[model samples]
Target: MTGEKVSFGFEDVSEEEKVSRVKGVFRSVASKYDLMNDLMSGGIHRIWKSNTIARLNPQPGELLLDCAGGTGDIARAFVAKAEEVRQRRGGEPAMAIVTDINDDMLLAGLEQRGDDGLIWACADATKLPFPDKCVDVVTISFGIRNVVDIPAALREFRRVLKPGGRFACLEFSHMATKEMQAAYDAYSFNVIPQLGKIVTGDKDSYQYLVESIRRFPKQEKFADMIKEAGFSKVSFTNYTGGVAALHTGWAI
Candidate 1:
């Protein structure tokens, strides 16, 4: 491992090592990812994602770049919402491009979604493939924490988005109440990994996932980080009493 280190869940490892380990984690869980998500979050992840899409307010003719779109949840919503707008107003439909660092995850998304008119690409979040000002919206849902360098990904989001374009992120967050936090901790540390083992036959991956959520910056801090990355109008809304959060910013 190199001297430059980063967190792979609760463990500290070299930057390269973290990337490889994270890739392995995703690859291991790719097939059962969506199912495990439903189990672990009790289907609240869907609600959180729906809240994110609503806040994004997808419109006709807009191009949405969904980075680390794993299993294509966000991209699917974006494309569908844009299509709804198009059918209602009689204009060209909006587009969504789903990019993921893990090929297995991308393949899973492809297989699950089939050809829904959403473009799929295997790409890294920190170094997005799109040209400058190429998209009207950029979103990374429940995936940014897995990035090796979140700031780099945020910068890439800014680069790809047109001025006035929006960036939205939905991810696990610290709970609002101490009582709720305690309960969440118990569930996270005890139940989620077991659920992962039962459902995906991979407990360690789920353990790492829970730990990664803890390692991620809290809601307000993440909003500031987005602003530091050159996003304006940065704001966040907590969901499910802060069990998850939706952070939004404008490229401006």
Candidate 2:
């Protein structure tokens, strides 16, 4: 992966360069990252996340590793659900670790939510810092596309999960209908950058985001990639006309 070139927005960049470039993009937008998500998705991002949590069906005492869990949204959701189950059953809450490659994003998350009993760490998705079979579930929400080596990251996710553990990912995906796709393309390419500039005062970062979403593999292809990474029972559920999707598999 050293000499090979990967994508940075619409441009092709060396693997090392792409990593730094993506980190820069997140750093630039870190201050307003959550706000940008709200604006970009018209608050539908929350719904998508809630649906992910529903599908995840988090259990008490299950450890969850949320890779690239920017601002700890997914981690928080998992923890909250775990706590709910614990309260009903009179047990302890599950553990959650929120990991991201960018310190700025992690720091921003700390500022907003103050840890919430979560372990916040700056760790790369492609090479996690966990031992084998350490966690019961691994999740990445709206973050996998930024990974320079997605297959490596998927393998890492599989490595960290215990047998029968689950891996779930929620990300921007291909729209299901042609008309919706056309409208979404026009909006993403046209309106998102303008919103970013107006809100975050950064247009290029949002442009890169749109391009990266386009570069991510479609749903079926991504599921295949997960299967190739040694996961079983791989499946995906598209939300909001496939604007976002949740892919789940078990480390069987």
Candidate 3:
């Protein structure tokens, strides 16, 4: 059943349908996504994201390839952190190359953030446009689960990294406590889409957001997938009691 195709949402779907559905969700929720992230997580996403940058151990003169990096939140965070380190050490600044699979998201980022050393490209995660061993670090946040092929994307992350390059993926993960699951489930199933409808006028797309998290590979299994992709020193750190997890691996 490993290769058996499944659709997004609760419906049974062919692989093609899943792709189409996910695309629609991003397009529909593009404008409201950043806001929804704040609302749904009660601003904890900022903490989760901040923690991700902290783990990157950002360094100067390093090149960061940000995958599925919509709106450049990770890019902004990286730039800020990298700049702070440079200021402290009086060294060169790190560079951030923002990459995303969606044009609307990329364009929104460019229009909102402007060109301040942030590079934007419309590229798929499974087919990254970079040379082998090219980037010093690769990071994907909240966007990997939206990918059509997780394993292929993982392999691609490995392929585009320099020797000893770092990879960090921050994603929604299964909840840790059984007591919390029901509350989370009820919030996801009943409250989330309704909140979306009230706020963004789009309920179905938010519904997809809830379901995709459930469909994602659990934490340990995902670490195994990263290892299988030829990444050494693969490990994960759970956050907010497993509401989200950050997986880090090195290409060695």
Q: Considering every candidate listed, which one attains the maximal TM-score?
A: 2
Query: Once superposed on the true structure, which residue ranges of model 1 sit more than 4 Å away at CA?
Result: 1-3
**TM-score of model number 3:** 0.95
- Whole-model lDDT, model 2: 0.94
True-vs-predicted CA distance for residue 135, candidate 2, Å:
0.1
Error of 2 at 232 (Å): 0.5
Q: Native-vs-model 1 lDDT?
A: 0.90
Q: Arrange candidates by TM-score, highest first: which order?
A: 2, 1, 3
Measured against the true structure, the TM-scores of the candidates, in listed sequence, are 0.97, 0.98, 0.95
RMSD of 3: 2.1
**Ten contiguous residues minimizing lDDT sum, candidate 2:** 1-10
lDDT of 3 by residue, 124-154 (tens): 8988988898889999999988877888999
Best by lDDT: 2
What stretches of model 2 exceed 4 Å from their correct place?
none
Ten contiguous residues minimizing lDDT sum, candidate 3: 1-10
Mark the 10 consecutive residues where model 1 has the least summed lDDT. Answer: 1-10
- Residue clash pairs of candidate 1: none
